[model samples]
Each structure stands twice: as structure tokens, then as C-alpha cells.
Target chain A: EPEVTQTPSHQVTQMGQEVILRCVPISNHLYFYWYRQILGQKVEFLVSFYNNEISEKSEIFDDQFSVERPDGSNFTLKIRSTKLEDSAMYFCASNAEGDRYEQYFGPGTRLTVT
Target chain B: GESVGLHLPTLSVQEGDNSIINCAYSNSASDYFIWYKQESGKGPQFIIDIRSNMDKRQGQRVTVLLNKTVKHLSLQIAATQPGDSAVYFCAEIGAGGYNKLIFGAGTRLAVHP
Candidate 1:
């Protein structure tokens, strides 16, 4: 079965540095999303992207965060300046246009900021 | 604020037994619900989902029951095996233009052999 895949399974960066988490969602899926989970916390929605634009975003998705679909298959999340609290497991998900309710998640990129 | 929450934080059951995990949602506008299983170091795997128009749905060895009046959802696994051990989360998609998932605090399921 086709599944969502993410790059740099584990990422470590300095507190003030930048990091980009990349994901390649299921090829035919139209909607893409990014979510994060702090250790021992529930997953929180970050943003949703469709048609090369952001559909919705949470308060945590402030100016420091941005998402891009630079290519047909690549969806990326970039953090301009990482904070200690920014360390968490970032997951990328996608669903087909016909089934918007069932989003499939990638293995996730573990972001560690020191 | 609307939120999804689990009834239990952890549940331990013997192998070959049945397991039922429960969830409650405060959002009446949520039209869809899903259950996901996450093993350690992996992402959430889709188990099954039910739409608000229906009260019950079944897939493989699992069944999902939704109570729209109480806003309750439950996932039942029959003849649970050791591999069934994982953290389960109930998620919802509210009625909106953007269908972003809202997850509940997960419930850890442990199966003892």
C-alpha cells in the first residue's frame, strides 16, 4: 500500500537555528497537513495546505512556521528559529480528495532543539 | 473549546480477551470520528472510522460504535493478541471547510500473554 514518507527521521539543531522537515505524501492525495506532539502530550494540529495555500492554522503556527509544496510530491515545514519548546515529533499527513476525513500519517520527524 | 478525551489512560488485558477503548467528544459539530493505533517510534495507523450518519461500523476484527446523543465513541477489538498492544487515539473532524483532525489524549493498551 502507498504510504506517506518523511525525510530526516531525526533532526537536531541549535536553539536559534533553522530546520526544515520534509514529507512526501501519498502521490494521489490532494490535501496535506502538519501536526506536532510534545513528548507525552496529545498531537496538536499546526497547519493544513491545499492548492498551494494554507487553509487553516493553529495559534502555535505563528510567524516562525511556514509550509511549502515546492514540488508536486514534496511538502515541507520550516521553522525560522527553533526554541527549546519547539522540540517534538512533527508528523505529515495527507488524504485523497474523495476522502477528506481519513488522513494517513507519516512515520514522523523527531525534531530536537538544544 | 471542543476537545476529544479518552475514558482511561491505560488498560491491561490478557491475550485472547476482548478489548474496548472508549472516547468522548464535546463537539456536537464533529461529523466524523476515527481510531488510530500507534506503536512506539511509529506514526498513527488508521484502524477504522465512522461517520455521524451511522451508529456502527465494522472492519476486520475491530468494530466501532458511535453514540451521537452522548457524543461517545468506542473501539472494540476481538480476541486481542500481543501485537495489539499500542497507544490508541480517537480523533475527530469537525464540520468545517478545512478538515483538520483533533486528537484525544491517547490510551495505552497492554496485552499480557
Candidate 2:
């Protein structure tokens, strides 16, 4: 079974530094999404992407966040400046066109900012 | 604002027993619901999903029940095993454009020998 893959399983960065989390979604998937789960909190949606444009984003996804599909296979999320509260598990997900509601998620990248 | 919540924070079950996790969603416009299992340090894995038009759906040893009237969803696992232990979450997707998913807090399932 093909699954979404994320790079840098764990990332540590200094506060005020920039961090880019990378993901390679399933090859055939058309829709991609970014989500974050704070320790001991529910997973929260960050943004959704389709056709190289952001479809929707949450208040949590503010000015500091940006997503890019720089290549056919790579989707990346960049945080302009990291903060202590920015530490969390960031997940990437994708879905085939036929089943838009069912998304396959990657193992996730644990971002730790200090 | 829409919210999804689980009935309990934790559930403990004997190895051979069946386990059921319940969720309540407050989005009437939600047309799709999914159940996901998240082990420690991992992302949510899709288990099963049901549409608003369907009352029930089954896959492998798992079954999902949906009640549109009460806005309730439940995931039942048969012959629960230690490997089945994890934090289970229920997510809902509205009929809106983005197809963003809102997840519940989640229920921690513990299977004991």
C-alpha cells in the first residue's frame, strides 16, 4: 500500500528561526493538507492545497505559515519564524479524487522549537 | 463553529472483548465522517468512513455506525487485541468547498491481557 511520507521525522529549531517540513504525498493524489497536533490536544487543520493554490486555512495558519508544491512529488510547509508555542507534530495528508473525504496521513514530523 | 467530541477520554477492555468508541458531532452540514487511529508519536491513520446517507458500514473486524438524527458516530472493534490499543478519533467533513476535516479530542483505547 502506498502511503504518504514525511522527511525529518523530528526537527529541532531555535526560536525566531525558520523551519520547513517536507512531505511526499501519494503520487496519484490530487488534494493535499497540512495539520498540527499540540501535545495533549486535538489535531487541528492548518491548510488545504489543490491546483497549487490554498483552498482554505484556519486562524492557526497565520502569516508565518506557507505551503508549496515546489515539484510534482514534494509538498512543503515553511514557518517564517518559529516560536515556543509552534512546537507540535505536523502531519501531511492526501486524498484521491474519487474519495475526497478519506485522507491518508504521513507518520508526521515532530517540530520542537526552543 | 462546529465541534466534535468523544464520550469518554479512555476505555479499557480485556484482550478478547469487543471495544466501542463513541463520538458526537455538532455539524449538521457534515456529509462525511471518518474514524482514525493514532498510536503514540504518529499521525492519524484512516480506519473506516461513512457517508451521511449510510447508517452503517463494516470493514474487516471494524464496524462504524452513524446516526444523523442524534449526530452520533461509533466505531466497534471485534476481538480487541493489544495491537488495537491506540487513541481513536472521529472527524467530520462538511459539504463546503475546502473539504477540511474537524477532529474530535479522541478516546484512548487500552487493551489488556
Candidate 3:
């Protein structure tokens, strides 16, 4: 089965530095999303992307966060300045249809800020 | 202002036994619910889903029951195996195409062989 894939399975970055998490959703998927889970916490939605633009975002997705399609296969999340609290597991998900409620999730990228 | 929740945090059962994971939701308007299984170091995988219009839906060895009046959902796994050990979460989405989801803390199931 085709699955969503993410790059840099694990990353470590300085507190003030920038980090980019990459994901390649299923080729035919139209709806893309970014979510995060803090350790021992619930998965929180960050933003949703469609038509190469942001469709919706949460309060957690503040000024420091940005997402880009960049290319056909790459959906990326960029954090301008990482903070200690920015460390978490970042996930990317996609849905194949406009009305389909099912979303496929990637393995996730573990971001560690120190 | 709604939430999806699980009744138990952990459950253990022997191989060949049946397991039932329970969940509760506060959103009366939610029309769709799903169960996701997540093993350690992996992402959440879809198990099965149910709609408010229906009371039950079954897939493979798993069955999902939804009680709309009480706002409850349950996943019943028959003849559970070791592979069934994982964290099970109940998620609910509101009425819409792009409706966001509310997830429960999750129940960790351990199927011992």
C-alpha cells in the first residue's frame, strides 16, 4: 500500500536555530495537514494545506510556523526559531478525497530542541 | 468546545481473549467517529469508523459500536493476538468535509501470548 513518508526521522537543533520537517504525502492525495504531539500528550492539529495554500490553522500554529508544498512530492513545515518547547513529534497526514474523513498519517519526525 | 475521551488508560488480556476498548464523546453534533491504533515509534493507523446514522459497523476481527444517545463508542476485537497490543484512540469529527478531529488520550492494550 502507498503510505505517507517523512524525512529526517529524528532531528536535533539549537534553541534559537531553524528547523525544517519534510513529508511526501501519497501522490494522489489532495488534502494535506500538519499536526504535533508533545510527549505524553494528545495529538494537536497545526495547519491544513490545499491548493498550495493554507486552509486552516490552530493557535499553536503561530507566526514562527510556516508550511510549503515546495514541490510535487515535498510538503514541509518550517519553524523560524526553535524553542525548548518546540520539541515534539511532528506528523503529516493526507486525505484522498474532498469529503473523505479518513486521513493517513506519516511515521512522524521527532524534533528535539536544546 | 467538544472532546473525545477514553474510559480506561490501560488494559491487558491473554491471547485468544476478546478485548473491548471504550470511549466517550461530548460533542452531540459529531456525526463521524474513528478508531486509530498506534504502536510505539509509529503513526496512528486507521482501524474502523462509524457514523452516527448507524449503530454498528464491523471490519475484519474488529467491531465498532456507537451509542448515540449516551455519546459512547467502543471497539471490540475478537480473539485478540499479540499483534493487537497497541494504544487505541477514539477520534470524532464534526459535520463537514474538512471537519477537524478531537482525540482521546488513548487506551493502551496489551495482548499477552
As a whole number from 0 to 100, the lDDT of residue A106 in candidate 3 is: 98
lDDT of 1 by residue, A1-36 (tens): 999999999999999999999999999999999999
Number of colliding residue pairs in each model: 0, 0, 0
Full ranking by TM-score = 1, 2, 3
Off by over 4 Å in 1: none
Model 2 DockQ reads 0.87
Clashing pairs in 1: none
- For candidate 2, the C-alpha RMSD (Å) to the true structure equals 0.9
* Model 3 chain B: worst 10 consecutive residues (lDDT sum): B93-102
> Which lDDT tens digits does candidate 2 get at residues A10-112?
9999999999999999999999999999999899999999999999999999999999999999999999999999999999999999878889999999999
Query: Candidate 3, after superposition: displacement of residue A27 in Å?
Result: 0.2
Q: lDDT tens string, model 3, B27-54? A: 8989999999989998889899999999
What is the iRMS for every candidate structure?
0.7, 0.7, 1.2
B83 in model 3: Cα distance from truth in Å? 0.2
DockQ (C-alpha) of model 1? 0.89
**lDDT of the structure predicted as candidate 3:** 0.91
CAPRI rating of model 2: high
Tens-digit lDDT track of model 3 for A42-83: 778888888888988888999999999988989999999999
